[model samples]
Target: MSYVLITGASSGLGKVFAQEYAALGANLILVARSEEKLLTLSAELRDKYNIDVRTLMQDLSLQESAEKVFAFCNREKLTVETLVNNAGFGLSGAFDSMPLEHLEKMIILHNLTLMKLTYLFLPDMKRRNRGSVLNVSSITAFQGIPYNAVYAATKAFILTFSESIREELRHYGIKVCSLCPGLTETAIFDKAGIDPYQTLMPIGPPEPVVRAAINGLEKNKNIIIPGLINKILIHGGRLLPRSLMLKLGIVLGRNKKAFLQNSC
Candidate 1:
């Protein structure tokens, strides 16, 4: 049977995506560092949805991780019909203050690993003339964020890349989507050492964001921005001068510490 392979499938948005696809009767190949969580989720999905769920414990931050996942899929004869590159994290601080290793790992997880996985699986999808790729970016991708510089930049790459490939794959009936969700209720802030309750902005729920992403992909929407406020923020930034947006970003970074801390 065909499967949907999701990286970072152990928790937060990735876990939600796995559950959403499982409910739709799609077999799943779940990848994450937490083998125990993956196993529990896999069993739950199999029991609840009666669809096959395969778990692969892999740390996607390592540059070679994607190759291992590809090899595993090939050896197991798993035909991946959908690929969700959702394994990513954020570092919230002055860029220089953040550990270089942390920054490098973030870059690898968000950009390099995602790119490599897409490159590896896209060929077979093209050959079969059917597939979907959903990449999780952020509203921050629309402009340069101050405190979240590197993270936003990586997401910008994802946004641009997803759009470019969506057009390339259009004639082949392969869907590629960039899911740009604003602050949602997730443990990302805590993981990044930022307290979400301190932020003033409304925190979105993961369910709606996941639903919107799936619905948008089904409708062939290349860019899926979930909330109205997020859409307004992203588009309004686009309308403003780049200098003005940069100034605003800096101001937010300096003045709105709580919101800035959790926004990315």
Candidate 2:
């Protein structure tokens, strides 16, 4: 049977994606670093949905992680019909002040690993002439944010890469979509050290975002921005002057308490 392979399936949007796919009666191959969470979710999904759920406790941030995941799927004879590259995190602070290791891992997880995984799986999809790749980007990809530079850049890459590959693989009947969600109520805010309440922007729930992603991928949309407000922001930002947009992003991206603390 074909499976939907989802990375970062331990929590947040990843967990939601797992549940959504399970509801569709699709078998799942969930990959994440947290073994306990993966096992628990696996059991829950299996019991509730009566679908096969395989869990792989592997961190995508490290080198050779994508290869290992591919190997695992091959060993288990899991045919991945859909690949969701949702394993990513954001780091907020002065780019210079952030730990180099953390920055490296973020880049690897967001760009290199995602790219490698796509490359590894595309051949199989091409052979079958049917598959989908949903890359989880962010609304920040549309513009450069001051403190969240690296994260935004990485997301931008995913968006552009997905668009490019979507066209390239169109003839093969493979769908490649980039999911760009804004300020969703996920653990990313806490992990990135940004308080969502302080941002003053509407924080959307995960369900709609995941729903939009799945729907968009089904329709072969090049990009899927979840919230209406998020869509407006991305589209409106394009009409503004580059300098003005940068200034606005700087103001919006700044963490209030951190800015005040740094000032003092």
Candidate 3:
């Protein structure tokens, strides 16, 4: 049976993706660093959906993690019909003040690992002439976010890469979509040290975001931006001057402490 392989399946959007796929009666291969969470989610999905759920615990920020995940799927005879590259983290602070190691890890997890996984899995999909890839980018991808520079840049790469591949793989009947959700109900805000309430933007739930992404992927959309407000923000931002957008990004991107400090 074919499986939908999802990275960072332990929590947030990744976890929701796993559940949504399982609900669609698809088998799943969930990869994440948290073994306990993965196992728990795997068990829950299998029991509720009566679909096979396999879990792999690996920190995707590591260099060789994608290769290892590919190898495991091969060894298990798991035919991945869909691959969701959703493993990522963000660090918010002045670029110079952030830890170098964390920044490097973020780059690896968001870009390198995602790219490697796509490269590893595309050959199989090509041979089969059928597959889908959902890359979880962010609304931040549309611009240069000041406090969240690296993360935004990584997401931008995903957006462009997904669009490029969508065109290239169309002949092979493979779908490539980039999911760019705005502020959603997820742990990313806390992890990135940004308080969602402080941002003054409406924080959406994961269900609708994942739903739109799956629907968009099914239709082979190049990009899926979830919320209506998010759509407005993205489209309207394009009409503004780059300098003005950059200034706005500084206010919107900063954490509570940074925003307060700047306000004073």
Candidate 4:
């Protein structure tokens, strides 16, 4: 049977994607680093939605991850018609303070693996003349986020990459979308060691991001900024002068100094 493949499916927006797909009677392949959480979510989705649910617990930061996941899918005889490359994290300190390893892994997870999966899966979909790939980018992609430098740059890459490929894939009936969401209520803040009570970051819930993505996918929208506020922010960044935008971004968005000083 055909299925939707989603990375980082154990929690937050990934979990929401699973549920949304399950409700539509699509089988799911959930990926994440936490095996126990993956299994739990799989069981729940299967029982609740009566749709097939599969789980892969893996750290996508590793170089071989995409190949390994493709192998697993092949072994299981799974066919992916929809892919949501949603597994990602953020670093909210000064660029110099961020650990080199953490930043590197983040790039691998956020950018490289997504590209690998799209490349691997696109060929099959092209041959069949139907498919969709959703790359989860961010609104921050419009401007440089001082404290979250690497993460923002990676997302900019995702948006550009997705848009370029979407153009090429259209004639083949393969739709590509870059889902650029702003902050969402996820365990991400805690994971990044950033206090949720912080003054600058405002977040909406993950459900809207998930819903908007699926809606855009159905409508064949190329780039989706889920919330109105995010749309405004993205537009605002584009409308303003570059130097002014950069100054605002640095003052309100980055923590390079703190992170650089404390980086391990």
Candidate 5:
């Protein structure tokens, strides 16, 4: 059977996606940095669904991890019918105070490594003429998010990149979708150093995001915004002038903004 490969499968939307796919009777290959969580999830899914569930514990923040994941897929003969590039985290507080190593890993995980994995697997999926790719971006991707400069920028790259390639893959019958969910209840907040309350406003759980993302993949929608309020916020931000948006973002993520600016 074809398999759904999900990075960041240890928790949040990634974990939800794994469960959703298994519910749909799809086999899975999960990847994450948390070996304990990954192993637990792998066993849980296998036991729950009686589907073949394999896992790889690798830090996607590392340069070689993408290559390793790709190689594993090839060796296992796992036809990656779906790819969920969902592994990422954010840092809050000030940019300057954050370790340079952490910043580098952020870029590597959010941008380069994700792009690398996509590029590696996409060609084979296209040649086979059947597959879906989901890049988990965020509503923060719309414009410059003050505190989340690099993370937003990386997501923006993912958003545009996925849309452009979605058009290209039309003929190949491969669908590429970018899921731009707003603030969800996840560990991303703790990682980013922002309080969950600091998130724009009230938001739904990651479950909707995962469900909508899966639906978007199946329908071949180029982009999926899981919540109506988030869709509104993203659109509203675009309608406003950049200066206003930036100012507002600073208020929302002051620690991040000041840190980045000071570091620069």
Candidate 6:
């Protein structure tokens, strides 16, 4: 049977996406690093929604992890009708001081893994002539971010890639969407050692953001940016000079750095 497969399905926006899809009566294949959490989420969804829920515990950051996931799904005959590439993390610090390992993992997980999963699932989706792909990017994808350089670039890749494919798949009745959420209430900031409450921007909840994304996808919207403030910032930032935008990003990055230092 066809199912929606979501990466990073253990917590944060990923977990929320799982719930949202389940609520819509969609069967799910939840992939994440934590087996315990994935199993728990699967049980909850299965019990509440009475839909088939499969769990795959794998770290997308590792080499060949995406292939393994594809293999697992194929073995189980779980045809993926919707793919949500939502697994990613940010590292906040000066590019020179940040750990190269973390950057590499971000590159693999945020960019490579998403690409592979999409590629693996695309042919089947084409054959079915019906599918949806939701790529969870960030508002930072609209411009360069100094402290979170690699992370922003990876998300930028997602935004552009999703747009490109959205056009190509339109003729095949496949929906491809890029969800560029601004600051949301998620553990990503905590993992990055940056506090969202200390930031200047308004942080939103994951529910509305994910809701807007799924709704947009249903409407066949290619780019889904949630929240009024974020929509303004993103669209307004495009009108500003590139140099000014970079400068503004630098200032925000510095504030984030100061907060991280204080927390440490």
| Tens digits of lDDT, candidate 3, 1-264 | 799999999999999999999999999999998999999999999999999999998999999999999999999999999999998886787788989999999999999999999999999999999999999999889889888889889999999988998899999999999999988888987777777787746788999999999999999888899988889988999999997787678655775556556656
Candidate 6 stretches with Cα past 4 Å from truth are 251-264
Whole-model alpha-carbon lDDT for candidate 6: 0.89
Q: What are the lDDT scores of the predictions, listed in order?
A: 0.88, 0.90, 0.90, 0.87, 0.84, 0.89
TM-score of each: 0.94, 0.96, 0.96, 0.94, 0.92, 0.95
For candidate 6, the TM-score is 0.95
Worst 10 residues of 5 by lDDT: 251-260
TM-score ranking of the models: 3, 2, 6, 1, 4, 5
User: What value does the lDDT take at residue 106 in candidate 5?
Assistant: 86
Residue 221 displacement (Å), model 6:
0.9
Looking at candidate 2, the ten consecutive residues that score lowest on lDDT are 255-264
Backbone clashes in each candidate structure, one number apiece? 0, 0, 0, 6, 4, 0
Model 3 has an lDDT value of: 0.90
Residue 49 in model 3: lDDT: 92
Residues 137-222, model 1: lDDT tens digits: 98878888777789889999999999998899999879999999988888787788765555444577899999999999888898
On lDDT, the stronger of 3 and 5 is 3
Decide which is better by lDDT, 1 or 4: 1
lDDT of 6 by residue, 148-215 (tens): 78878998999999999899889999999999998899888888888776666788889999899889
C-alpha RMSD by candidate, in order = 2.8, 2.1, 1.5, 3.5, 3.3, 2.9
lDDT score, candidate 1: 0.88
Clashing pairs in 2: none
